[model samples]
Target: MEHNLSKHISGKFNQDLENVRNHVLAMGGLVEQQLNSALDAVSANDSEQARQVEKDDYKVNAMEVSIDEECTRIIAKRQPAASDLRLVVAIAKTIADLERIGDEARRIAQVALDSFSKEQQDLLVMIDNMGRQVSKMLHDVLDAFARMDVEAAFKVHKEDAKVDREYEALIRQIMTYMMEDPRSIPKIMALVWSVRSLERIGDRCQNIAEYVIYFVKGKDIRHISQEDIEKDILKL
Candidate 1:
């Protein structure tokens, strides 16, 4: 009877761990869907689709809260240490970034459907490309977490620099146009907001990549050197 009870408790604990993992993956799926919806809304200039993103923001917020609460409960009850602890802590931290990324994507969708004229629409091409790249980076980082693939995470981290450069050049080009013609103020401001939203997405990608190190090797990889990130990636 004692052996049977111990086996039952162990099985239940493993089941709870699996539940926690699924909750995180479900949250990831929701965010990925949000990004895709925002992209479609932007590309089509659909105000209804933009409204959908705005509506969906609440879901992401709620999921973040749920995951956070669940993690807290698991840590207190299970007393996980080492790698298990790292995974829980990393999820708790990364959920915030994921929520913020969802917000940024929704903001872009809103701004894309804003009252910009035809000419302003043409200039949104670069902004669109940046959005695609950032979304893919987010997806890739999540994949790394799923598989514990450190190399994939680092690749996402390095790719963010290109996004940053693109954003800088984009800002410069817009300012030049605005300077060349003062009458383009409102359109330029709208474009600026759009570009800023895309840039923010890239920033979140960088944060998520840093969390990957903690998820695997139990290290606070933030503010650490590139060489260290590379070394961790080499392990997977």
Candidate 2:
């Protein structure tokens, strides 16, 4: 976490890097808000809040583009090397993941605009439970990013498995419902898509966590098993 960002000869260069990093954290906060609001909309059946989440997606997209442009500008102008370059790369990747998480939140919000049956309410409850876990994961990863806490990032990475299990179990439940009443397929499909989005958000959170580990440890841990990460890379 002890990044030498202030070591550059040009104070402006240091400030520029700090600004871009702060913007990424700001973007993360916005995405987290969108996710929480989307989940609340579905749970409370508030179309108004859902529509608001839909409307605010553009903000996330805009931040991504802006931060990307800034990062590009930094590389072009300052020609950052070593850890500074890694910082920029990590910010780029993190923002991309945050934007996609926003998209997933929007997808989840769409389910709120439509009505569900009494029986289908159970499925929505399942979705909400999974959504909350994913939301917590997202929040934790962002906090990890802000503090450059590698251990926190690893914790979030391991948490994705729980979300996956929840997603798989929900899918099976939905499939069973569809089998009981063929007529419920269309409605069940909507729930299917929402749950899938939640699962994907969990994945994006894991990706951000990887970026954190990469930034701090300068190690590329993608495609590596958690056991391997702990036993090999993290043990260092």
Number of the predicted model whose lDDT against the real structure is largest: 2
Error of 1 at 58 (Å): 0.5
Q: Which candidate is the best by TM-score?
A: 2
Flag regions of model 2 displaced more than 4 Å.
1-12
Local accuracy of candidate 1 as per-residue lDDT tens digits, 1-236: 00111222244366665676678778887888888788777777788988999999999999999989998898889887666666677778778888988888787778646766676666676677777887888888888766656667778888888888989988998898788878998757877876787788788878777777666555677777777656653443
Pull out the clashing pairs in model 2. none
Report the CA-based lDDT of candidate 1 relative to the real structure: 0.76
All models, RMSD in angstroms:
5.6, 1.9
lDDT of 1 at 129: 78
Q: In candidate 1, where is summed lDDT lowest over 10 consecutive residues?
A: 1-10
